[model samples]
Target: MAKQYVRKKEEVLQTTVTSIRHNEYYNMQKMFDELYEKSSKNESFESLMPIILSKENILLAYRNIKTNGGSITPGTDKISIKDLKSLSSEEIIENVRHIVTGKRGYNPRAVRRKDIPKPNGETRPLGIPCMWDRLIQQCIKQVMEPICEAKFSNHSYGFRPGRSTENAIAELEKYNVYSNLHYVIEFDIKGFFDNVDHKKLIKQIWALGIHDKQLIYVIKQILSAPIMLPNGEKIRPLKGTPQGGIISPLLANIVLNELDHWIESQWENNPVAYKYSVRMNKNGSENKGSGYRAMKKTKLKEMYIVRYADDFRIVCRNKKDSVNIKIAVTKWLKDRLNLDISEEKTKIVNIEKQYCDFLGFKIGLKHKRGKFVTESHVADKNLARETEKLKKQIKRIAHPADDKDAATQTYRYNSMVMGMQNYYQHASHVNKDFAIVAWKINDLLLHELKPSRQKGRLARKGRELTPMEKERYGKSKTIRYDSMTGIPIYPIGYVQTKAPSNFKRGKTPYTEEGRKMMHKDLSINTTLMHELMKQTVHGSIEYADNRISLFSAQHGKCAITGVEFRDVNEIHCHHKIPKSQGGTDEYQNLMLVLNEVHILLHATSNETIQKYSELLQLDPKQKVKLNKYRKLIGLETI
Candidate 1:
């Protein structure tokens, strides 16, 4: 009976493959000709296809199967990873290779609908790609990653290599610094993943010059095939590219690239307004004493759009342009791509009217020392909401009556806390309000350890600890607790709220231990600060702590004069390039100098600064800062 079942499945697969081969929808000749044309221009589609295809082997298939983990839900064929693993590794690899080579038919994917809870108490359908189907998708993704990485725009920060939510937010913040920002349009596509027009997506992929035969065939099947819902109902979607598959994001990005291109084209005609320079003197106004410096002029479009997956934030210089942009983009998505724009979700607001929120950060333009800089803060409301949600979840899992072990409870708690922290790290890094939230969450984590009140002889306030007690305890901040189990629970850790430095205790909000703890909590490496400071010290680097550290590291002495300054009031932070020429507050472009030396450096020619730097006999660190500064000012560095 089992042999008969296996034979029947093989017969069906053979028929499917035959149909795929004879499917006249794709023009093989045209695909080949296009590949040949692309081959002439550097590394082309065809040139790389072989390498991508060759990578499908037994080891990878086995690894992906093992990594797929527990759900093991079956596809349309009712074959799960458990069933697939029943076969030998060689057999599994051969089957996958055959499918990849178009010798076997692409299996119909089964859709398992998962209800993902949203912030507003609404749930959305997340389509779970089937076990076998996901395995194939993983293989395709591994091969296609390197080939696709370079093709996407830098403005896009979704699921691309070396890009992330932070990068996207940072770019948006950079734009906000210009101060000409008039309106921000937060655009949304209705049912973004589920509403993708399959045919339209295919055309967009072709437009991107991706026409590899196997690749196209796999995509077509993925898009056009019917999905079997859990209720034993098989439905073929009329338009949408299925939501929860590996290929879905890649496909969506390809379609959205068209929108990016359209935006860039329109910008050639719509230039932004220019205003007075934000660069300032110690008194917080442009240094008019140097000479009559002209304000920076703008020639490019005064508008830009940034996207992450389906979310888009468009910035424009004026209301007229904002309205026009929203209309154009709406029409373009509808007419060109057959995509629906969510009218309710598409919002345009004056930057002066209200702050724009995207990817969880509240973005607004703030006037800092007469210059406008983008101010980003995590919403207190959001942090509170997440904290409450986490409390509810932790209570359910770590119930007093539950039999779960400490390790299991700890694992669950860590996952929830880490995920929340990562999402809110940018805001948490600056928001003092986050400490309250963290304290509450820490209390929950403490309870999970089943700790009781500490029962020990306590010393009164102002009494010194015994010598043995002092020897037994170091300076780690901890909470003492007696445990229900024989082992006592140690301190429950809290997120550090400051950066550490060598400055006096009250000088800055950061401390050495606090900075290290903060970095660990944020999952950021200290090397990032070191790397930024290691480069030529400039104002373009916006991180103030590292800039101050660079100055302190150099012993508060003017790099040129080698004169020590006991008071920060005597020092000036100078921009390598004058504000009139588009210099920014980045660390690489800023330097601390004596107030007199600063005035001389700005008043004199670039040639004189270069000569001064040479005669000053700068140390290695100072030399790097001077060289970067010289490069910005178009002077030859020694």
Candidate 2:
């Protein structure tokens, strides 16, 4: 049912798992801040090359690209980060410089084309950028991110740092719950990533003062790069950036930001959101945006929009405004971005009888406390699909194995369940949904572990129990594993209200500490990290086993940096070809490296190498080895 819901989005299958993810600049945060300040006040920039090509900026850019997903995905040249680890730091940095500076030419290689199955049984195309192109894209992205952040809508959540689907949902709630909005205009621009107009996007970028000719030349080339399909057929794009490129989302946002601004001008900005806003105090309430009498006299109807990537929703207090805004938005996108809002998915519905799906949430109006409140539930279709996926995963991994293998299986099982929990931690019914799923998984695990079909008490008992179990469950039992190794079904008892988010949303990322906050924000789902360890999404025991063996083989030293890893999280099992960009997970593919060193090995950024060398007090020889691995994994060597 979930997959079947969006029936008309055919062209999107040609892009990567691209719609889903964003934020930040580091070290050069202040420099970017200055750009943001200038841009916020509507000024143009020239001669940004020094900062963009500066050793530090390039290093930080690589840092972001390497640590984030996609460092491993190959481009037209069929080169990925794995191929770049041998480059010395100077060689890598010089490579990025040459690409952007036109020393080696700014032309990007063709995208290595691929497709992955979407939940809807449709395949999504992945235009994977080469390591070199990816690095340069990030280099450009880092410079442009802060400037763009200065101008992006608070309502725009896609690809920006700190903003998320939940945040977008919360904004929807503000209009639906706090206000009297009743009608929903829900729609997504079909094939938005694939259809972005190159000329218009560049004009928008220049408008933002990102007018560096060389930089502009590089981006134009990236945009113009061809998509190489599986049969080696190349499709040169006249519009739109590749879905997997680091800059694709930013470009899409920039292109659609025009849509954001136009709509805001009509409703949010032209009159300003507060043109008809309200507020209250402890003792009294006030219509601060306007007096009650003026609000009554005014002919304005309030409209609010919340957007994440290509998908967006416009809410209004009446059908007339909703319909009008929808019509206006349709025209705006066609006229501005030259994209079409999907008629199948885009509908204006009353809150009482119908609802719209956004970011895996079922959003509609709920009558609460004698009033209708805009509320979201974990969509039934999503729960059903996720539970099905969980059941299938359990079928594969929930074996009745003996000894440490049981412990390992238990760890694998918990990771899957926990990942699901974390992915929905921001849900209003996280507790309830997790309970239902966990119970089913628990029952299924017990069934799989039993040597034979056991009835009644035996079935419930679940193998021989230890003293800790008896104390916990008395006569009845839950699934059991090695005494020291595994856990029962993880409890889903915590309430995850949409409490105030500490994240500053669009304002974070390119700011100094925002990158850390962005990483923290994005880390709500660590399961993806493990799932990303391989292409087919295997259980991580093999990966884990390799990490243990490699650590012992090296006596716990990082393979590249040869430094001691103090933290467990720092112990990364890197695929010599990283799974982040789609590497396979065989024993031969494994490498034990500390997280920081892992960055260098799969690196796009150079800050850590510089910082680590100073902190660990490495000699020239050791430092060279570190930089050798620092060869920005995205471009030269890749």
Candidate 3:
């Protein structure tokens, strides 16, 4: 257990923390915004060296990397954030600056590779970069992002600064309610990130008005960095951005942006296919004098797309258009980017007849109260997976004599349930579906948590009740063990539903102020009370998470006097088992109580106890629990 941990509830609820920047960095951002604004308005640039190599920008990148959570993982260099922390600020800035300025010829090391378990029980590879290299990449990403963002299509929403899965999902559902477009074309690119053509990507960067020769050479170098696999084998890839690199998402988006533009042209701009409908000039923009904008002011678009990374869905007004557009897109991807679409995975479905899966939500039509409407719900696969997962966890507790007690198991189980509910709270029938899941899962809980009644059950438990003996408990859903611990278990459907958020309208990403408005998170919708309610935090708990966990364990009261904590400043974490006596960092050894109580517990003289006399006054129950806690730590009770 840690000595202490604390944080404001408000901080955890925010969608994102504002990037901490120095005063000088603010001016640099303004300059970057101005340059990016020019490129967005059809300007060209031959040099970005002045901005990229500036000392202020260099320092800012270093600061941001230090703040970033991923900086801890080491690359092939075997230097982590811990090593960087050992150096002075000036020393680190100089080291990063030398590499960026070509003073040391900028040799990038291979990425450290590891695999993580997926939700569906599969594994995916991840690349970890050293802090030094991440600093250089961050320098380029911060500047390049604003410039690319201006020219990037509004429909391409992956890895963008202000965009998220929620925005993309909302856009997908918008066409459902606003238009008669019921046909959907879903396509998966065959190894999108792994097969991205380096030549084609470079051309796209040039097309975006960034033509810095030196910078381009450096980016190419980064793309060619070798991969150090788990088995001590190193492989150099000719194509594909490694999944875990800092700039991989931006690089992938640049490759996909080309696809976004070509699709937009065929759907809205190019007149060869829609000559009978509208007239257009050579450039993709509409001809204002030709009444092109006015003619279709009230008309719904026949085709459009919403893309996140490699996943995309094309919606059309009719099945004929859907099939044609799908063919056109397949040909276009091969010709323009030299990539192939997965024929086996791709399909065109009439959404009105059957639903399509996108971003974990089922998008299709629903007949409700005499009207047919489009709505998204949790996929059946996810519900089945979660149900089976709970059953397995309950079985471990019931049959096996594991190290974990009933109280610890109950807290962890509840935490897992709360996290799942938080993710799917936006689904339309989530409450209804989860109620069914809860009904099934709670039975498993009741079976394990309740003491056994059979003859064999008593011997297995070491001490238990018989069939003739009786016991009292709360509602069937609530699991309990004793006066303390074994918290009530709630299920997925417990959380209230939250509506999806609409994107910032009429604001372009080119300007500094416009980007500011787009980045604002005014909604305070996340509820973390259940996250805090867990009596024990599993695995290695973060400092903030430990504070929240112990706060729940205390029930927000001073353990000695049983008084509610009026302010967070008064709360303190006490060690139940002293470190000198061989207590480790495991969370079970710590307790949250009042500052006065913690000081009195460590008091060596009678005068010290008398100094905190008011706080020492406890009722019979508090005195008993206090003495119990004291005995564990080898101390005498006041």
- Over 206-308, each residue of candidate 3 has an lDDT whose tens digit, in order, gives 8898889878887887888888889989888788777777788888889988888877775455454344444455534344433334434434346778888
Ranking by TM-score: 2, 3, 1
Task: List ranges where model 1 is wrong by over 4 Å.
Answer: 1-58, 61-65, 68-87, 100-104, 178-182, 268-301, 393-404, 428-430, 436-482, 485-638
Which should have the higher lDDT, number 1 or number 3? Answer: 3
If scored against the real structure, what TM-score would every candidate get? Answer: 0.59, 0.74, 0.71
TM-score of 3: 0.71
Per-candidate local distance difference test:
0.52, 0.61, 0.64
* Tens digit of per-residue lDDT, candidate 2, span 501-551: 422543364444544444343311233323322223234545554544455
Cα TM-score of candidate 2: 0.74
Q: Pick the candidate with the highest lDDT.
A: 3
**Tens digit per residue, CA lDDT, model 1, 1-638:** 00001111112222222222222112222332333334325354643445433433333534434433333655456666777757765676666667656545665455665566666677666666766667777656644543454345556656553345665676676666644665889887888777777787777666665677667777788776676665767787777766667566677788787787677555521222113333455533343322212212333335677777778888887888788888988998899888778898788987565778777667677666987755555665566676786677556444533222422332344345434443455542444555676577567755653436643211122112223223322242542322321111222133332211111111100123322332232212222222222233223223333344446455445665565442333457777786778876665656777554564454356765665454344588766765666567665555
Model 2 weakest lDDT span, ten residues long: 8-17
Please give the ranking of all candidate structures by lDDT, highest first, separated by commas.
3, 2, 1
* lDDT, residue 487, model 3: 31
Q: Which 10-residue window of candidate 3 scores lowest in summed lDDT? A: 1-10
